[model samples]
Target: MASVKPWSLVLVVFCIMSLSYFVNGAGSNEGLGASFIFGDSLVDAGNNNYLQTLSRANIPPNGIDFKASGGQPTGRYTNGRTIGDIVGEELGVPSYAVPYLAPNSTGKAILYGVNYASGGGGIMNATGRIFVNRLGLDIQIDYFNNTRKQFDKLLGPSKAKDYISKRSIFSITIGANDFLNNYLLPVLSVGARISESPDAFIDDMINHLRNQLTRLYQLDARKFVIGNVGPIGCIPYQKTLNQLNENECVDLANKLAMQYNRRLKELLSELNGKLQGAIVVHANVYDLVMELITNYTKYGFTTASKACCGNGGQFAGIIPCGPTSSLCKDREKHVFWDPYHPSEAANVIIARQLLSGSTKYISPVNLKQLRNL
Candidate 1:
């Protein structure tokens, strides 16, 4: 036998220790479970890559910082992982949830979880018609239903039912596109806004979401974290379109978001009480995002009002992030990555909060607690 050198022994010990720490660290809890993500562009994990829509991010500079794809665009709207991706990571998910439409989202891949999110999708079926082929909440849920059947086939009906009910977490982060692309479209929204009051439109949204959640429950989804609409008014797109100052957001847009958020909170509460053995929690995205935008300095962000990758004047909100877009030198210093999404840095902060923050942000139970349940 050959004798080992002192330096080699030390290096071996260091590697062992590092491996132990990783295997027993924050996400080592046995309760860490599968994450089934559902949402819009904010949490979309490349579902749009398969769609023939104009609202795509599978281009240069979109995922320039996403290490998973070797700095290549993976169709995520932001420069890096979405809040969903970060949350999943912090919770110890071994791999990123595969996009439901990805060619590899089959066989053993479905055991971990699947991402059914789509950019430009909303709670309503007609919300993202402008995108031509975007999958709305209704369609995403339909896809999940198919996945549920697949699970039954893979694990047998009884075992699959138990696995879904006890070992999975479903996260839904949607609703912004309904207002931004439907009720607020300058040309098309004129007719919608004229015909329906904000109250009526919001009511429709609530009704649709209620049915959607109920459908998920019927499909054996027991754990849910539903994030409400964030402050769309403060995004670069709204600020640039409205020509507002740094601190001023589009009032109409903010009002609509707040209205929908209120109703969404009520809906979640109702579901929590009505759905047997279900843990439906509300994620206060509006207030959390508003706090970030209002006191970006506190969060160590240099500019919360501008997009790191976009073109046009001021906040660079007019043009979407694309090949010819103006990319920021320090991507981590900015809050928004594009006109409509938060950068990976901002997403990290938000994901941390959602993971273990107080009830003030994530009502009843935070994500960590939800996972352990």
Candidate 2:
């Protein structure tokens, strides 16, 4: 795998979202039952509510687009649910509640893990540097460790080991906002460029990420499903501000992401090799998302270029698309649910691909190899 053409992220020539191409979904949760997630908004389910940051979504218009239409207490970016929410239900669990930040009512509720992903978090502890209070990745893990300590006290070592060993599924989706908000934006004030070259920057970034995850593994986290970055350049938000000016993806950003994913595959393979019975998986969001952009006509998208809400401008991607802002007549016919996020309809399709296997991207072993472990 040399350099990935922005168009062909999946194995097929043009990586469109057919869902029909991969036939072996519904198998990822084969033995695993519950999920514990920690990252950023991509997998966040309301953890930011407890934190003090302006990057909050627990307001009006946020949940308006969801299937529950605000009935759901979920703080996901989507109108209704995220892939995490769907997968939780699929695993016969309730909403994957935010751990530590979200309170557990009973002693036995620790059976399934909770989500600790803050909206602006990253692999480094660099999230929310602009705001007063935010949990960086290291602190988030610290919170997770502390909570696990509590669970250990309550459940006792034997049952805690049982829960950790048997049905615990760990999902981590992060890194996009690390570049966007912390590094790219002019206002965050911390403009520390890891390096000038995209390749070097990504290597440094994900390498830093691997060390943190390795610490988690040593602490008893067994199963891991790491999400690959989506086509950040194609996002209406990025396309509006950065892409159109250059008339292409912010190649620096896109290239870094591609390199990150490419390197991530090799890193994950080696991790699986070193850690027996532990799994490392990738969700090729780059291809799943391109379907919403280039092949909009085929995917029933009426407007792939603009978000459904607000002016469809550079800022629209920042908030939810609803009454206070602009609203598309139909959502199923569109791709992005928000300027920064995907639709409920889109997530279901992406979830299908991830469950199939990590391959079509990862080289030697597919997800089946990890699951068999």
Per-model TM values vs. the true structure: 0.92, 0.81
Query: lDDT tens digits, residues 1-373, model 2?
Result: 7997765665564343333222211123454444677787777778777877876667645566566444443567666678776666665565455455766623445445677787878775665566556566787778767756756776666656555655576777888876776666565533466334456556767788788788778667887778777788767788766537422555666766677778877888889898776776666677667655677777666766667655545535554454577766676665677777877667766665565545664323333344444
Give the Cα error of residue 179 in candidate 2, in Å.
Answer: 1.1
**Candidate 1 residue-wise lDDT, 295-366, digit = tens:** 999989999999999988799999999999999999999999999999999999999999999998997999
In model 2, the runs with Cα more than 4 Å from the true position are: 1-31, 65-73, 187-191, 194-200, 243-248, 312-315, 318-323, 361-373
The candidate 1 region of ten consecutive residues with least summed lDDT is: 20-29
The prediction achieving the highest TM-score against the true structure is: 1
Q: At residue 201, what lDDT does model 1 achieve? A: 97
lDDT on C-alpha atoms for all candidate structures: 0.90, 0.65
